[model samples]
Target: MPTQGLEKSYSREHIARQVQRLGEEISRDYAGEELLVVCVLKGAFLFFADLVRAISLPVNVDFVRVASYGPHTQTTGLVEFRKDLEMSVTGRHVLIIDDILDSGFTLEALYQKLAGRKPESLKTCVLLDKRQARQTAFEADYVGISFDSGFVVGYGLDYQESFRSLADIYLFDPAQSV
Candidate 1:
């Protein structure tokens, strides 16, 4: 896809710094404990990978995929589970990692689902938190960045399955696309 309509939001260095800070914080919080890092795909894949590596703890990684925005910029208020975690979360210190906390539907739904599994402790982390767009009352325990508005793409965020491989994040304006 062309990058004609994209405006840089966050540089790769900035994102890395934030991720490292989060990792350190997480490591400190869960010191002497094992962590189950559950990644929300496919947006969180890159963030998840970097986060786990930065975290200095014994962490087991798993992935779950949910679809709320099939091919749209905004959510449809429906969350469908495409994949589930293979590892059990019971009695584990679990952390849910996601790309963005938009409408709160996807993260909240996934959080509730995992909470029902009865983990010893459950918390959430998001690369980006857009409080203005929230449709449900939900908040992430850890947030990498905050934005008032804009559909972002890059650093694993995407639009129509593109721009995810970009090194930095950008405000995507579809109307300006070539």
Candidate 2:
């Protein structure tokens, strides 16, 4: 592990089960419709791949890169769109996937931007939901897990762009930061 005092919160099996359940739910809800899955890049890439594979329907995938957190533990509060979706989502069922929902600022901003594109319906799916850190009035339509608060890394999440490759999700103990 890159960081000491880290504790495993969610095992790889647990995450797989959750992803399967979510995929089933999505497939059931949008059985007759085509899905355009938009993945928030870098962090959500791993989760996005697994999730799309789980879905029973054929899905079109696109990636958008946004940054609100820099080389620190907290959000910078300024969201920057490093990249945008390549395909148009208009008149399509669009699903936005992210690794985590932290302060909601980044997701909220992205939602508004995509919503303005006039997708037939837009929904958000997040692997981790840190509700305690939410600063905006935005919520994911499909959430895998809801955690209180911690700097978590694994399964596509990172710490200063590290630890994302871990199979299990681990919580970074702030007291151990040096």
Q: Rate the local accuracy (lDDT) of all candidates.
A: 0.94, 0.92
**Best of the candidates, TM-score:** 1
lDDT, candidate 2, 1-178, per-residue tens: 5546679999999999999999999999999888999999899998999999999997999999999998877898999999999999999999999999989999999999999999999999999999899998899999999999988988989877778889899988656767
Over 1-178, each residue of candidate 1 has an lDDT whose tens digit, in order, gives 5566689999999999999999999999999999999999999999999999999989999999998998989999999999999999999999999999989999999999999999999999999999799999999999999989989999898889999999899999877776
Give Cα distance to truth, residue 93, candidate 2, Å: 0.7
Model 2 weakest lDDT span, ten residues long: 1-10
- The TM-score between candidate 1 and the true structure equals 0.98
**How does candidate 2 fare on TM-score?**
0.96
Off by over 4 Å in 1: none
lDDT score for residue 5 of model 2: 69
Q: lDDT at 46 for candidate 1? A: 94
